[model samples]
Target: MRLQTAVLLALTLLVGAGVADRALAWPPDLMPADALPLKVALRAEAPAPKAKVSPVTGPAAACCAVLELRQYTLKPGQRDALIDLFDRYFRTGQEAAGLRVVGQFRDLDDPDRFVWLRGFPDMSARATGLAAFYGGPVWQAYREAANATMLDSDNVLLLRPAIAGSGFADVTPVPPPVMPSPAPLPPAPLPPGAPPAGHGMLVATLYYPFPAHDAAAAQDLADAFARDGAPVLVAAGGPVLAAFVTNPEPNNFPRLPVREGEAVFITFQAFADAAAYDRYRAHVGTPWWRGHVLKGAPEVRRLAPTSGSRWQGPF
Candidate 1:
């Protein structure tokens, strides 16, 4: 089904918004002399009991699952073995199990880490399919063979589709848009005898549910970091890029919408490089994040760019 239709159905199934006078009002152009009499007659009619909708009772329209796999350092010439095994086993197994792989990326900084997303019909189907896939013979053999090359820590996230569309589809391949080579940025004067490190860039994004009451509080945290902490690093001759919060919108997976309990607010920050990102995280994000943002919010997810990844605009 199309995303808009699914959203409409989901909203109808859930608690509906109260009817307003504006909605009931006939358009001036469409109204006739008899409209006033009809309105009066409708007002005289008795009200009916509203249908009760249980908040937690209904099935989600769709679900998205993220699986993160970390591999151990490969032996000499074992890289090809691991790749071929993943191609021949994991990909085929997941397809057979009825889960659609949406996105896949290999970490540029850490070659061992692999991240992928999958979509399911709903929560129940996701749970059933995942259990059956893991328990099946194909999965067992694949796991046993890859055990030595796999990292101990793996992460999985089972998320309900917030709006009405499926997650990224594996079948319809999309190539990333090529970024133009950087135009020569204007040079800034540096302190005498300072050595130059090439320009680096980092981007961070934060998402929050809509109608957030604590937007001011979050903005304050961002302001403090930029004014107080960033200046110190910049004075030490570090290059800083722009930082700002983005407005929330529908997720890349059309099924997830702003109306759902998903994030309503989004904050994005861009820095020069990994060193700057690390410094900001340590000096700014870690200390302030927990008390100001994390504590105030229910959930947050973070990601970094790598090979085979696509940007899903803020949601």
Candidate 2:
């Protein structure tokens, strides 16, 4: 597990865009023509069935039981500028405001795009933390600068750990000045088109969508991934960091839009660079165990680091 959760929350600032651009389409190499159907309707039915909430309770798992997967499409060439501001100022202020800033990154395929994760102890904490940060002085001071770096900030997914032991590894905190300078991490000798692998670690986020109507199946699928699918991915080549199932908890703070009908199991894997990711892909689907465990192919999103990205700790 990695401790990228708390720093991301501060990066979500006050902004208004009529609409945000959707994530770049899944990569061609990853999305096969005969692959399992990838699209699901985004809206849940009215009078939506209540999503069950199961908050992880304990001292060790203090952050990120409930998380948000946030992606922002920045104005061309403005992604790094945002990351600089986030690392130097926003992350510290966000923590002070009581929000968890999970990990943040640059999208592998889209240079102008950024993605990050945020966590909450529970839904109520989410409301309070967000309210405190959004209404507090930190955001008010930097709102314009932060808003200017973006084109849209609306793409977000509310998620939870797929199973026990499914949160980020606790990385030691590196204060802004003491952290390493913004240089692309050395690339592992991976080939082109794998996840980006230059400055920092690359994370491959696999999204496995279940039938919108089958809530039980969604949990079952997540369970199966934890028991069977994860090992296969590791055996093939992925060094998995963590995996999570989408929480059914309705978004208490409706101010930020969430995907209503979608249900997915998400997995994270770290690679030295695109080449390492490609190596994992080479062995991923061909295994016999895959046919036994996976019911369908998943939608994949690979993220790499911007100059400002950081992943610390034992993980």
Candidate 3:
């Protein structure tokens, strides 16, 4: 299908499923003197189209223009508070300023961890948008509330989509929060076809010990998984989202910490639940993984989205 048609279909599904509603702006009164103008900075392209077949079954394509895999280590018992603040105050100003708030979630393995994703049309846009959001009014009003919930906000990886049709489908903007609430509620369940919670999406990051400085070598690795390895996992009943390869460009902003050194590749997939994950695990021992996807023994981690996560639509 055409990219535009696919995106429209994705948006319709999200809205019908009630995932399109949520807060998107920060308080408007607090714009900073030097902040980049929100309107100019937010010139983003339409989200990339979803693939007709599994990305793993084809060649690697650039997913989103630029993707950031971010993880925040919050204070103990503060994950919910942090997510509440984010849901209420972060999305609006951030997206308005230029960033695409892809999704937010609680780390299933780490109670104090909050993980989320956002995208940009390119690196230059990322730098501009982040600057505006940090320097803008919404953050000014709620910075303290937001900061109080986190102990660390430095775990981040800059990536590009690894396969054809690997990026997220276009989504409707999240509605602005209607009013401040005494407590933030968990984000609604994902729409039909999304991986279920107990056995929901398994977002895995594969950290390779060697530098993937060679473009050909990197493509080879990513393609191996996309074209060969991904099909094996799907046959086992796991639905794959997109896989990504780290972008080697130096961090444009010296401020935020993204892991440097070592090559990394990430995969997003989902199963029915824990039992389903186990079933996939049983298949992992097969030759394909040992000889291809995991042949190098990359560091792999699996994560599930927390209750307050807001990812609605075509994955």
Candidate 4:
């Protein structure tokens, strides 16, 4: 997978592996009055001639160009209840309705937050699938239990892959092992053909209104990073797997909200372990662009994948 976005920050900000440097020039303020327009969304490519795969797998995932990056704020101590409800009951039912549960995770930085990704073939499928799943028997039956675990569920980002052929459509999903009942015991053994459950960490970085630069400057910066920054990240021991940008299209499914009117670019990376991630930080001395290029620092989340993910990148 290719993280097609966040080229600017990940590539530029190597200084200290995070945090802004407070001693640099603010370039955007010096620009001419007009803010040049930037092409925030990547162009969509034509599809291949293969037969459509229902419950799309790998190559068929291109069907789901539109994605939802949802982060929920849960009430303290309610995280386990929500995960149990989701792992056992929600995954299959949602898939059955034509949407894909791309992956789910526990935010290592914040124990009270749950993060998940949902995919749709397109905006139309998004509306259709969401309506069905939310109105279907499963959600109707368990909605109460699911809702009880959260204090807020509206922190969602509507996004799409940043480059051609770099979408989640390339991620092959495995059959999630669901519990027979909502019990606290460990999950049963994996059936044949499933990848062995493994351990690792995923880091997500967000570039939101990377303050100061005009649209044109931001786009130029992003392009530069895509070409030069990837190798730097790899050299630092973090393999960024996916890149995404905000979907400018209006929210067709108004019933479920998404973060609108905000400029966001994101990158997802995989690390072998916590220690490996630490080494990566030490390798990249401070990012030279931190204080000079972006006024506001991007948000980074170190994530732990949940077992119920239909797909969790190459990890």
Top-lDDT structure, candidate number: 4
For model 4, the stretches where C-alpha displacement exceeds 4 angstroms are 1-64, 172-198, 210-221, 288-292, 312-315
Query: How do the residues 70-170 of candidate 3 rate in per-residue lDDT, one tens digit apiece?
Result: 88888887776666666656875576676777667656677778788888778997888778777766776677777887888888888886644456543
Q: How close is candidate 4 to the true structure, as a TM-score?
A: 0.70
Q: 28-114 in candidate 2: lDDT tens per residue?
A: 223447765232212333232221111111112224678888888899977766776666556656666566676677777888888
Q: What local lDDT does model 1 show for residue 247? A: 19
lDDT of 4 by residue, 1-315 (tens): 133233233222221122112221212322236644222111144222222121213234342488898999999977766776677768777776766787777888898998988887688878888887777777777787788889999999998766543344434442332222332333333344423332567788877544442444444444555666655775576765556777778898898888776766677776666788889989977652354365478788887777676545343
Error of 4 at 101 (Å): 1.0
Q: What lDDT would each prediction earn against the true structure? A: 0.36, 0.55, 0.57, 0.61
Provide the TM-score for each candidate, comma-separated: 0.36, 0.66, 0.66, 0.70
Poorest 10 consecutive residues by lDDT, candidate 4: 15-24
Ranking by lDDT: 4, 3, 2, 1
Model 4 score (lDDT):
0.61
Each model's backbone clash number: 15, 22, 11, 12
Kindly report which residue stretches of model 2 are placed more than 4 angstroms away from their true locations once superposed.
1-62, 171-199, 287-297, 307-315
Candidate achieving the largest TM-score:
4
Regions of candidate 1 where Cα sits further than 4 Å from its true position: 1-81, 162-292, 295-315
